[model samples]
Target: MTGARPRNRKELLAAAAAGLFARDGFHNVGVGDVAAAGGVTASALYRHFQNKQDVLGHVLLTGVDELADRLRAAVSGLADDPGRRLDPLLLAAAEVSVERRELTALWRWQGRHMREADQKDLRTRVGSLLTDWLAGLRALRPGLDPGQTQLLCFATLSVFGSVGDHRATPGAGFAELLARLARAVVGVDLPTARPSSDQWRTRVAPPPSRREELLTAATRLFREHGFHAVSVDDIGAATGIAGPSVYRHFAGKSELLLAASRRMADRLTLGLEDALATATDPADALGRLARSYVDTVLRSDDLIAVYTTELANLPERDGRELRAMQRGYVAEWVRLLRSVSPGLDEAEARVVVHAALTIVNDIPRTARFADRPGLAAELTALTGAVLDAGATQP
Candidate 1:
């Protein structure tokens, strides 16, 4: 009898490694596990990749290459006129995000893991792609400055990446939402009365920050308005302190943004950890985490808003660290999901957790269209129910 053809060892190993990396992360996933997943020997995997890091390098380059290709194809037909060509590209990019969220997640994970040299190389590749992307954009929309164009590009990619295929309707996906974001970038009215740094600095005051005074005041202002909307002036004004003086206590708005986001995430994290540590029943941890995440996000729609929109732009070291913290936040949830659902593989559970987190983060947008109070509660409920169901089932 003829034996069945052997699977392509290289292709199978790479795919398995990508899945494992996406699931367990760079530090946790082992090459042995990946090789096993591919039904191959560890040596066979080693033949293709030196180690797990090499697997990550491969995953990173592959994802970026796909994005570059999609972007290139998005504009190739435009050749000359970009304006008309742009609408399709935007829509197409969104479709890619929807269809390829796994790859998208891998890209995000790898970027977070990237070292300086890797980052530089990826940036160069992206830069080249963006130059071409811009050419396409310029053809479509003439007379935009490099600054303005760059802003549009930056904002579009950020919002689009998270939200890509999401949204309930035609108006919700990347292209549609992107058009609005693009319009906002190009058309939103900047306040004519801008405060000078000194003026802002003077208006701010140093806080005698104990936890309650800091978080209560900070949360109220940030949650009510937004990160950018509520500047140093607003924070000080909220605390009944002079604006500039506020800088003495907390560095700037970015820190404040991360602080507010972390506060919410921290509460949920602590709650989940405590629940896991204290609970007698192993079955309840996933439910507890789902409740923890939902409650924390809905408690302050403003916090979720900043978490989704502004935290991405925070200053360095702080930004990187906060992101890793955010990952930890979700990872705990994923860990619980894996425990509760035997049918769901670790990698599959991770994808579910990510989708749940995205929905939670995007709560602000949902509130904008619907009732903030009611929808917030409803969504939190819906999220808990869904995750619980996911946990109970597979």
Candidate 2:
């Protein structure tokens, strides 16, 4: 069904494609689907974009443009008062979060489908926005080193990005709540030095087997390159085996993805069990959960990345099972959060839990911050702050 014709076909197509790609995933959406959604013919879409990938590039860049313009206007004429700038900046970001709910998802997962040059451009533009934020934050808190300031900026971005992860109806003061949480992240006190004993550095010995090596190699390749971009041959080469040899251990690339995804789910489940078994109370349980999560993500970020972004590539049944497992894990967090703070409703607790987890997942994957000393401790503190702020929301 063709809808009303848009005033500008290009913008309309990009917006339509963004929503579709964000909801259904890039690999699942086709050029005709985008054209129909935009209320235009396929030929007309071709006039604007060369292909589906081109449409995706336009959608992502357009979102980045909106963010840059809005943030620039939000902080206009407030350079002298750097402390006051963050409030309007964050508020503007919150507005984008609500208005363009698909943006974060597009940037996080779908952009991997783009060519490397396009991806680099996207990163550069987004990096400029983050640089602006880092300047403002550094001005307000001069004591923070470069790494700490950058980490805070990334965490703040994650707080706003978390909105796209769920479909729960926002409560009253939703934007205000997000801004407050971002502010809390910005104000977190980071550690000045790495811990004397770095647990993340301790590596386990690799299992001795061809199949295990193939699985390990496949997960990393899938993480580095999107699932559709990698192949059985690529996975085999990484393990010094022929492409056909990969099938001996796994039936196909799909099987490798399913195996890698299940590995991630199993690790998270084990972490939760560990957290539950050791905690004395709900609050303690939540803290242990957060710490366990940070540790898990830090140690196995490639697995986490593959699990999060490659869900669309899994077989239907496996996808459903993994997603259900994910929901159950999140439910446990929500349950513990509500127990810790009886005032928080289920929806509120869920949003808060997502924001906290997003920070943990996102910050450690960031290249600059990933290798920094004391990141785990700082992340745990930031997680606590997010939970504390959400728990006491008035």
Candidate 3:
């Protein structure tokens, strides 16, 4: 089926590869799958990309180029003022959430699996776009330092990327909703003083059972190296066990992933339930939940990372059950937010909830705030700002 025009054929192959990589993990999809998806034979696909890695690099690098180009084009015709230009630039980005959903997801998930040199190239390209955004944002908010500007830019991007990860369709108004939420993220005032860290504590803990030790080791490896890249023996080595000792604790690597993912989900579900018990009202309950989430993420980032990224590697039945539990956790947040903001519809509340969670999830990765004082308070305030932004949408 090698029927595409010579010029368009490469693009068709790249597009097919992006969709396949986004739908299935990059490690899971093979050159044959991409060739099949693009309506071409393996030989034809190779003419465009040297191999599957090459295909991934092409999709990711080009996708980043297009995203930056969209932001640039969004402001090209507008006034030179940064504040005046930001609206259209953001709206254009939000529109991409719908138009280029697969490409967006590819940038977020598949880029992580690239080879070292490819990963460096991808980061450099993404960093350049982020610098451009910071330049404009600094112009608008001269009070913000480069760190704050970078955080805001990444947070805003995360909001748009959330559309690809979820099934929510807020009718046709999703773009506007995303734009509003993103603008709120950008408009947030970063804290100047380092937050107080007295409340943050580390536990001096004892040893765990062999099964628990294996799960812990698996979670860290899966977070660092991806799920498919790590093997049962890798988990065993990480736990100081030899050879097939890992098998006694778990059926296989997938079961270890499922255990780590389910543990994270259960912690979140249980933590929120515990917070709601003593809340004075819905607002307090939401605030408590937000703080608890930030603390948990800050402490167990590896677990959270694996839970977010590696759950798809689980067997279909296990993956389905885990995802159901996750959705229920998010649904609890939706219920609490709706209680606090009665005017927020289900979709609006869900978007805001995700925006808030996105901040918690992405901010810690920056590493700047990982050891900063008042981290929880700052994140909680940012979450509030996102929720407040959603409130003004209607």
Candidate 4:
């Protein structure tokens, strides 16, 4: 009856765990929650997963299977040209990313808690996946290394993940974002901005601020690179502070994480509060809010990454508050949308608002104007359009 029936049971557990994790977060969801959702006991869940992390490990591995299968099939439908295949693969990957955002976030979140071995395995699988996909892209691109390729790859799938995380419309403008990622990765000569030795010493960045410099620098570094990819020394070096001195400012990277998260949560709620007060109407409010959000995102290509990737690393209480803050923001948006429509009840309004917010939240993923000659205005127009639709008078 129980001959290692982990895959089937595991998929159910993963799906259930993903729902709860996405609903709350990793730290909030216990083994019992996952087991209950899967209609099994915690003991049963443990059989497939050593712990919550094992659930995430399966989600990640499942993503590889699902995305690779989808990409391979989707790529077949595209023209042989590398540029053409890029979009199709991106579309397929984006779809999967949206469908899988919760687990994807978990997979990302695990960077905080998973053992070093699990983390290494995850990296290896990811690199192998990209190396294979990049092989298809190799004929079109030359001279790109794994580092560059990996960044571009992360940028590609991440856009969709953001869309899903933020709730982008299933079909709206997804293709455009895909095109942008493809073009940016291939068409643009985006040479990494390496400073000369003297320049590195001069212009890389100033020494850490005397006032909360260590914390600020660490947050920026973790956000700019990644929690796993960055180190305490990197933060210290960036800010011209002592690595050990980081302890004076904060307990460790995890504590620093909560601080960064608190900053974001404060901003999110504050922004929403301010936006609502000034808004003339719900739609105007939504547009203004969406505009502000997009503006922030455009300036911060790494903003969503900070929210999605590192939030999990924060200590438990802080992470809960941040999630609550986000929920409140979304809930506020939904309430405003309902006021605008009057036609939809609260639940219906939430459905509509969430769908729209998802798209608005996805600007960083799909926006290409930053690189496009006149694309900024185009992106602005698109941003306005979504806000308008969400905010438009009934």
Query: Best-fitting candidate, measured by lDDT?
Result: 2
Model 4 superposed RMSD (Cα):
8.5
The model with the greater lDDT, 1 or 2, is: 2
Worst 10-residue lDDT window for candidate 4 reads 193-202
Judge candidate 4 against the unseen true structure and give its global Cα lDDT, from 0 to 1.
0.58
Best by TM-score, which number?
2
Residue-level lDDT of model 4, residues 229-287, one tens digit each, is 67877877877777787777777888777766666666666668778899898777876
lDDT, model 2: 0.84
Q: Rate residue 361 of model 1 by lDDT.
A: 57
Candidate 2 local lDDT, 176-295, one digit each (tens): 778888888988877666665456476587666998888889888988777877889999899998999888899999998998889889999999999999999999999999989888
lDDT per residue, candidate 1, 1-394, as tens digits? Answer: 4755365666667788788766655555677899899887898788888777677776677677787787777757564866567667767766777567667666754444555566677777778767877666555556665544543454345444553212223323324443333333333222222234113223556765554355566656654443434677777777777878777777777666667777766776677787788666655766556656655665555666555444545676766776777677767776777767767655545545554565555543433323332333444444554355445541
Error of 4 at 69 (Å): 4.4
Off by over 4 Å in 4: 1-208, 224-231, 251-255, 299-304, 344-377, 387-394
> Candidate 2: which pairs clash?
none
Give candidate 2 regions above 4 Å deviation.
1-7, 77-79, 204-207
lDDT of each: 0.58, 0.84, 0.80, 0.58
Native-to-model Cα distance after best TM-score fit, residue 170 in candidate 3, in Å: 1.7
Deviation in Å, model 2, residue 333 alpha carbon: 0.7
Best first by TM-score, ranked: 2, 3, 4, 1
**Candidate 4 backbone clash number:** 7
